[model samples]
Target: AGLSEAGLDLPPMTAEQRRASLELWQRRKAAVLYSVANNLATVAKDHAAAARVYGQLLTLDPGNSERICAALGRLSMQVGDLQSARHHLGRCAQSAPAERRDFYAAQLAVTSADWATAQRLFRSALDSNPGNMLAANNLAVICLYTGQLREAIRLLESLLERQPKLAIHEGLVFNLCTMYDLESSKSVGKKTRLLETVARHRGDNFDVAAFKF
Candidate 1:
């Protein structure tokens, strides 16, 4: 009946032949769905519409692929559909490839204010790949948020030492300055030097009034 509805004639066939035919039909349907979703995403730039089409494709494939979940997760995040983003990104994190999965899921968790999960994911990413500077920086931020100032300082300092160019990173410098101000009574000279260095890097357009010591 389903094949007939799609204008396919049923031929007399063995069980294996019928199974192969159904499989082919399902594959063709999935290809069509993927094409439509790509067109919606690229041509129309309609993230929501593309996400819906991907959701439909997921129903048909049902855990057969993680690419669809990842795409849908990113699209949902772009559209501010946090619930859908969490669901799809969580699925992707569990089933997809390792590269960037934990980082992206942690980011989404941060957006949702699920601080514990974000911290856990960031930490997990760091543990899995100790060279992940982004994960280390994000975890350091969580430590700062929770008032683990010393830990944040240590983490950021380690990062900056490993890549001294990171000293020019505004966020890292800001956090370092804050930590120094809060933890060190003798930080006035150090803070002044840090700000001066930043100002030098930024050149003439840098407004001294914008920075309050």
Candidate 2:
């Protein structure tokens, strides 16, 4: 009684055809879910709900779509789900454009306190885009945290030399002043001059006025 057996101009679907049909259906369903998740995330501001929906979509599509994986990764991070963020972001990083993958991977590494990996990825990102001020700033911060003061100073100095007008340059200058203050070899006059420069750029908001040498 089936339509194929009844010869009603309908041919039996092959196994491959059936598999393709099911995959298409799943992809359509995943698309709908992705839309709903985005709406929940952006319009409703329900990150938890959006993450849940995205998790479901991942179950359907897995890593077949890089955008979906990247969205899930970002949403997971927003919800403090570092483990899930690492998983999804790792997959996304594998397929992301070369210019951006290292940046995304570096952020994930930071969440895990993997400073070495983060440094490497951030450096890679900067190497690919030398004008990436954010990457330079982040790498400099990591260098400072790890007590690589000379490297940190070099990074900030290079950035300033290239783009002195960048608003974030003030922060770099402040960090440089702090490093100079900590180094006994740096003369008091030099430190004072650095602090004055920072003060000029940062105005009254510069807190180094109370910092004792």
Candidate 3:
């Protein structure tokens, strides 16, 4: 109304801005649709639908699409679509740059509790960087979860030696003992000594003084 009185109204949309706006809308629309489909498929236990939605999202935004594919593969695995899961994960793994590929692929395998695969990947990561505590810790967890009691203990022990008095070691000791039952774990002389130090609170957390990674 004020514009009319001033003989000045809003100008028509510019072609470039309009085009950009339209593209943005399309991207947002695609994202929303894919998100909705993914949620619905999760609720309905429809891994195929979820995969399709993720595929569409990739089409809409090719950059950073690896995460989307990884998510789709996770759902596919949940629904027993092993083939589809493998296919999507393979694509994501291959498309990822060398630096990021191993982590993503390792994560995918870890999600599925493919401990053997995780072990291999974690080794590769460690070989790449011997001081990668994160990789070492994750490998220890995988071992513990997969019934490799001795291996898990050895991992924690080594880390303790490398970085003693670390609080995370306490948690690791707790998990290992809880998993294997302290008695069974301590049945071995090496394990007994490790657990005794942990239980006695000699150094707190990791007790680096007594061991080396």
Candidate 4:
């Protein structure tokens, strides 16, 4: 009964037991309920119930409203409810740093298919954190799709130089190698260089197929 009230599926419980569990849960401290909400989201994958818990937390634990809003925004995004995501993420972004603020806005713009705004906001996100490989990858993808092949290649190449050990970011590496194929007849050499770089960091586990050689 307690688990069900905490957003889990289990065998049926008597109405009296269910009522008792609800009373017990209502008596739980905010911190305990917060932990339960986290477990519901992470372990049980009960996002809807977790979101409700977060909404309750917003009023119960007002001091940590920003953090709760951020978590709720992320969960809304995960469930593909962009309207809810925009509301919560916008609230979180108001107090966030440039990287987080613009990244959230960029995600919203991308969802709306506003590539120009997304590109600008993602560039701001990357500029605020030079080592942000995800922002770099996002910017490069926008450039690639907009017919700016050289700019796309340059962004990824700059990321490689800035954070060489990040070869594990397969998407960035794959996008860079893809641009190499598009921009040069001698892509094999470019791919070889990328492979060599990956080999240094990944040792034997690096997949040769990622280079598209």
- The most accurate candidate by TM-score is 4
Candidate 4's displacement at residue 134, Å, is: 0.7
Candidate 4 structure quality by residue, lDDT tens digits, 82-174: 888888878877877655889878867866779999999999999899998878888999999999999999998888888899877676778
Q: How far does residue 10 in candidate 2 sit from its true spot (Å)?
A: 52
Query: Comparing 2 and 4 by TM-score, which wins?
Result: 4
Residue pairs with colliding backbones in model 2 are: none
| TM-scores for every predicted model | 0.49, 0.48, 0.52, 0.61
Candidate 4's displacement at residue 29, Å, is 19
- In order, candidate lDDTs are 0.76, 0.76, 0.67, 0.84
Candidate closer to the true structure by TM-score (higher is better), 2 or 3: 3
**lDDT per residue (tens digit) for residues 35-131 in model 2:** 8998999779898889888778767886656777778777887789899889888887887888989988897897798999999999999999888
Stretches of candidate 1 above 4 Å error? 1-9, 97-100, 109-213
Q: Report lDDT (Cα) of residue 25, candidate 1.
A: 84
Candidate 3, 43: how far from true, in Å?
6.8
- Which pairs of residues collide in model 1? none
Pairwise TM-score winner, candidates 1 and 4: 4
- Cα RMSDs of all predictions? 10.5, 11.7, 10.1, 8.6
Worst 10 residues of 4 by lDDT: 1-10
Q: Which ten residues in a row have the lowest lDDT in candidate 3?
A: 204-213
TM-score for model 4?
0.61
The positional error of residue 92 in candidate 4, measured at the CA in angstroms, is: 4.7
Q: Using TM-score as the measure, name the better of candidate 3 and candidate 4.
A: 4
